[model samples]
Target chain A: EAGVAQSPRYKIIEKRQSVAFWCNPISGHATLYWYQQILGQGPKLLIQFQNNGVVDDSQLPKDRFSAERLKGVDSTLKIQPAKLEDSAVYLCASSPRRQSFFEQYFGPGTRLTVT
Target chain B: SQQGEEDPQALSIQEGENATMNCSYKTSINNLQWYRQNSGRGLVHLILIRSNEREKHSGRLRVTLDTSKKSSSLLITASRAADTASYFCATDAAYGGATNKLIFGTGTLLAVQP
Candidate 1:
């Protein structure tokens, strides 16, 4: 079986530039999540989606960050006018929604470097 | 801010020796999970222990959870070079509902020398 997939494995952009990362979850998984892992720290969740609707996005920087899971299969996270602190790895993960508790399968992640 | 802190920020052990890491969280949780991440990669699930459970074993891994103290530990027996990676403990957001929101703790970096 194929694992979660992410694109643009690495990205580098200057401050104030815009950057976006894409993810496609494993087949039949209904729960999707986006997390940011800053250097020297564990991943911090940015948002979560169940199907095409968002379940939680309280941690996302609303002013400059936005994500969408169009068609409930693929998702995209964007950081516009990015800041230096935004440099980190963007990881996407998914789990089956059939159960109340399930393990998440993660993508390789997209490393963003905002210089 | 991170919800939990992993003890022994880093460890270096011989390949045949056992390695252990501990995690402490602040809130009540339905379950606790352990994940592993290689350098510059995403996390992979390792094991999960529910609040009622005390211990769980998987392959060479042993996990213990103490809800009264709100702490968990992961132990890797007969560690190998392949066990070298950062390990993290995560808990549900505990937002008053059954959600998959996970709050991760600072990870423990383990280096096993072959």
Candidate 2:
């Protein structure tokens, strides 16, 4: 079994530029999540999806951030007009289900550096 | 805002010693989990303790949860240099009909000297 996979382990962009990150979750996992982890801080949930349907995205920045899990296997998170505050590691995780006991598997995050 | 907050932002100890980290949460939760992250890598789940349980052990890791106090602690005994990493606690918020979203705490950076 493979762990969650993410692309472009590191990224750098200028302020106001657009950037996107991709995630491929573990096989058979039914839930996926995107989180933003600022330096010296815990991860903040951006969005969550269950089998291609969004389960929660209340914390997502609708004006600048968006994510999609089209096939329920792979997902993408995008940030447009990036700001200096957006410079943080974006982590992707997946779980077997919404059950409380299921441990989530995380991917190597994409460290975005916004200039 | 982080749902959980860990105490003693950093800890340094020698190998074969014990390292303890504490985490406190604001709201009720179904379960609490601990994860470890090596430098510049993803987090790896270490242990999970349900609210109904008081303690759990996996190898050298021991976790204790106190629902009444709304806090949890992780104890790593006989630590090794390989155990040097950032440790975080995540809470599964107790909410009706809400997915099990793990809200993480500010991590504790542990450095074990060999």
Candidate 3:
């Protein structure tokens, strides 16, 4: 009955440094998503997972950002060699199914500040 | 790479007034959804309207979708200060059936003064 959970509500790191965020989706959720939201802009989908397999990663910056949903229950997003542009809030969301038209439940998000 | 753009980037209105925000997207979509985000929090789903639906309503919220115009509008009637937040519209592409990927628009910031 719990909502999606995320850790390290805030993070600060220098350019070229690396950081990782953890997320636990609601019980029985089958879809997980990672999004990046810049100041004054909408959240952009970075990656999506259905169960333990990836459903989409078309917008992910493979060279610097990586995410994995192990066992289809928890997910971790990592950013290596962080850039100034990467300073934004990272959001984790989940849905009961992989089907469309379902509303997503989101976590509080991790705000990253890259200097 | 944003798909939708909301009009009137920001709005300030008094409580009990009606606030309307419009969103226009570039691609065909299977459905459109609206979400709200507070100053320092994650987003909350407000409503979802399918492509076949021209209008939908929730408590104090009315959503109208015009697929022919690739536009949608969200109207909050008798708004309250607690309704102050950023409103965003999202869409899932209709290319090969509806997928889980959602494209969000630049949100509209609404402030309701009590």
Candidate 4:
């Protein structure tokens, strides 16, 4: 009965570097989501997956940000050539499948710092 | 941007006082939810109100959703210093069916003085 788990609670890298984050959703959850939050702002949706198939990713920066939910269980978010603006907290969330109203459980998040 | 926008942006009150925060959204939604985040970390789900419900309560928390006005309000009665954190309002504008997306607002920072 573990909550959503994320690795590398904190990360610091220089601009133009690359970083990856891993997430493990609660067991039996079928929906996964990744969000990016800037300082003093709310979290913004970067990508969503339903059973390993992407449901949305319109807000994702395709040039550098990429995420994949493998086998509908775990997910990984990667940012290559990270830019200064990409410095923010990345959050992962999950929910039960096909729920009429989403009640998502969130992870602590990975805080990325770009120098 | 169907995200709900929380008003005031920040609030500070002493322990045992009541705290009220308002949220407004531009689009129609099926439900509204509130979340609490501490220290810019994980967000904890607080409450969820369906469009049909006008008001709901949980312990010291009270939530009112006004679909007619596309707005909502959260009130914490006799709040404690431990309640200090950032509160956010999220809306799911799934009009036709299931969009499975929650649009979050900018959030309100609440600081409770002991």
Q: Highest DockQ, which number?
A: 3
Please give the DockQ score of every candidate, comma-separated: 0.62, 0.76, 0.82, 0.63
Model 3 CAPRI rating: high
- Native contact fraction (fnat) of model 3: 0.79
TM-scores of the candidates are 0.97, 0.98, 0.98, 0.96
Instruction: Give candidate 4 regions above 4 Å deviation.
Output: none
- Model 1 alpha-carbon miss at residue B50, Å: 0.8
Question: What is the C-alpha local distance difference test score of each model?
Answer: 0.92, 0.93, 0.95, 0.91
Best by lDDT: 3
lDDT (Cα, tens digit) per residue for candidate 2, span B1-114? 798999879999999999999999999998899999987556999998988999999999999999999999999999999999999999999997446899999999999999
- Least accurate 10 contiguous residues by lDDT in model 1 chain A: A96-105
Please report how far candidate 3 places residue A41 from its true position, in Å.
0.2
lDDT by residue (A16-84, candidate 4, tens digit) is: 999999999999989999989899999899998998999889899899989998899999999999999
Candidate 1's DockQ is 0.62
Candidate 3 stretches with Cα past 4 Å from truth are none
TM-score of chain A of 4: 0.97
Candidate 1, residues B13-105, lDDT tens digits: the string is 999999999999999887889999996555899998878899999999999999989999999999999999999999874556768778899
TM-score of 2: 0.98
lDDT of each residue in A1-72, candidate 2, tens digit only: 989999889999999999999999999999999999999998899998998999889999989999999888
Candidate 4 colliding pairs: none
* Model 3 chain A worst lDDT window (10 residues): A96-105
